[model samples]
Target: MHIQQLTIENFRNLATQTLNFHPQQNYISGCNGSGKTALLEALYSLGRGKSFRETQTRHIIAHQKDFYRLIAKIIDDKAEHLLGIERQTRDYRIRLDGENLSGLSALADLLPIQMLNSDHFALIDQGPEHRRRFTDYGLFYQDSRFLPAWQRYQYALKNRNAALRDNWPDEHIRPWHHQLSQTAQLIDQLRQIYLNDLEARLNYYHAELGGLETLNIRYHRGWAQDKTLEELLIQHLPRDRQLKHTRDGIHRAEWRIYAQEQDIAHYFSRGQQKTLLCALILAQNQVIQESSGKQPIILIDDITAELDPKRRELLLQFLTDSGAQLFITSIEALDTPKNRQHFFIQAGQLTPQS
Candidate 1:
C-alpha cells in the first residue's frame, strides 16, 4: 500500500504538516538537521510502530510539546486503512481502523516497510541478535506459521530458563525443554528454508548493486548440525543448569555475510558494505513482495551517502523501475526524470519544490 496522506504533529522539528504523497518516487531534500530525516522517522513510526533514530518514544516529542501524533492514510486496490500512532511521556498507543492494536505486527501487516539507515550496518558488525531479528522478520512475513512457532519457542525457552534459575528439579525443566525442542525444530526448519530462498534472490541483487567480490551468506542454526535440538538439549542439560539460560536453540540463530570467503567487514570496503546491506534489504523486499503480493514501502535514508555518482544512478534507476513507492532523503537536491517529485525541507518546514 502507498501512503495517500501523512499528518504529523509535534514530531521532532517538523512543522505540523499534512501532505499528499506520490505513489511512486518521492524525494525529500534538505541540508543536515533540516527535519528531512525526522519526517522519515515519523513515516516509519506509522508502519513499524517506533522511530528508527531513537529507542524511546518520548525522545521523539517536540521540545515544547507534551505528546506527538502521526496518522497515515494508506490505500491499495481494495480499500483504504488509517493508521494512527500517539506517544505520551512513558507510553505509546497504536490504532488501526479506529480501534486499539495489541500487537505491532498489526501495523506491519497493514503497511509493511523496509528501511536502510546508517545503524543498519550493525547487521554485519553486531552480534547475532540483530541478524536474527532481520532474518525472522523476513521469514515471519513470508511463512504464515513462522510467528506462532517462534512465539511458542520463546515462551518455552523463557519458562525453562526460569525453572533453571529457581533451581527446579529436572522434571519441571525437562517438560519445558521438550516443549522448546519441538518448536525449535520447526523454527530452524523454517529458517533454513527461508535462507535457501533468500540466498538465491540475494545473488541477483548483490550483482545488480555492483558487488565485485564473491558474496556469500552462511546460516548457522544455533546448534550442532549433526544432532537434533532435542538431543543437544539433553546433552547440554548440565551446562544449561549451570548457565541458567538456553545456549542452544533457534534463539541463538546467526548468519554470516562473507566476501571472497572472508568476513565481509574485513574484505569489503565501508562503502561496499553499505551497498551490500541495501542490496540485502531490497532482495528481501522482493521475497516479501512475491510472498505477500504487496511490495513494502522502501525508506532510503540518505540514499546517496557514500555512493559514487555512477552507483547512485544505478540505485535510483533500479528503484524507479521497481514499482514500489520510494521515500528518500538527501542533503542536496537530486536531478531525476520528470516522473519524480521533490520536496524541500528547511528550518522544520516542508514545502513543495514545484
Candidate 2:
C-alpha cells in the first residue's frame, strides 16, 4: 500500500497544502525547525492515530488554529481509497473511503506503517514495555486472533490486580486467575511465534547490513517455564497480597537483544545499535508483508543521524529494494539517483525540487 497524495491543514507549523508523492520513494529535505519532521508526523498520524513527537492535541494543532486535519489518497492492491483525520482539542474523527470509523484499528489495518528515527533507538535502550509493544505491533498485523485475546487478557489482569489490591478472598480472586492464566497462555504463544519470526528475519537483515556478530533474542514469558501461570499465581498469592498487586503474569513479559551473548547496548557502538534497530524494523516489515501480502509504508525521520555516508547508502538501498512506499527526511538532499521525487521544506512550506 502507498499514499498517492496528502493534504494537511493547521498541523503544527505546516501550511495547509496538498502534496503529491511517489509510490516507491520520497526524500524530504530541510533545515532544523523547517517542518520536515512535521510532514512525516502528519502521515504517521493518519495511520497510527497519534504523533510520535508530541502527545497533546493542543500542541499538535497550529498556533491559533482550532483543529488539525489530514487527508490522504491511499492505493492498496490497485484500488484507491481516501483516509482522513480531523482533531480538535476535545475530540477527533477518522474517516476511510468516506465512512466514519469509531476507532483507529481500521486505519492501522489498511495502512501498515513502520517508523524509524533517533527516538526509536529507545526500543533497544528502554525497558521491557517498549520491547513488548514492539512485538505486539507486528502481531497486530500478522494474526487476527491477537487483539481479541490480548484485550481479554488485559481485562482479566486488571480485575485480578483490583481483587488483590482490595484484599478479596481467595475464592473471589480465583476466577480472574483462571481467566488470566488461559488468556496469558494464548498471548504467550502468539508472542513467541511472532518473536521467533522476528528473530530469524532480524539476523538475516543484520548479516545483509554487514553485521558480523551473532545476534540473539531471548523471550521471558513472565512466569517460570516449568510452571503454569495458575500455579505461579497461587504460589505468589502471599506476595501479591503484601504488595497489593499481582506479582507474576504475562504483563511482566520481556524480550531482550544480545550480540555475542552480551547486551546490545553494552556490546555495540551507537551507530551499530541504530543500524541494528533499523534492521529490526525492516525485518518486522518483511514479516508483515510475507504473512499478509501487504507492503507497509516506511517512514524515517532524520535519516542522517549517527549514520555515515556509506551506511546511509546501504540503508537507503535496502529500503528501495523492499518495494514499500518510503518517506525519508534529511537536513540536506541525499546524493542518489533521480528516479524518486524530492521535496524541500522551508518555514512550513514544501516545494518540489527538480
| Tens-place lDDT digits, model 2, residues 1-354 | 799999999999999999999999999999999999999899999889999788799999999999999999998886999988999998999998889999878878888888988887788888888889889889998899988888898898888889888899999888887888998999999999998889888998888777877788989999999999999888898899899888788889999899878999788998789779878988998988887788889998988875777767787788778789999999989864678899999999999988
Task: Extract clashing residue pairs from model 2.
Answer: none
lDDT of 1 by residue, 1-354 (tens): 699899999998889989888899899999999998898888888878887779876678999788999988999878998888889988888888889998888888778788888889888898989889888889878999988898899898889889889989987777876778888888888998988888777778778888877677899888998988888888898999899888998889899888768999777888888778867887888888888887788888887785677777776677667778889888998885586678999988888777
Name the lDDT of candidate 1: 0.84
In order, what lDDT does every prediction score?
A: 0.84, 0.88
Highest lDDT model number: 2
Candidate 1 residues lying further than 4 Å off, grouped into runs, are none
Worst 10 residues of 2 by lDDT: 305-314
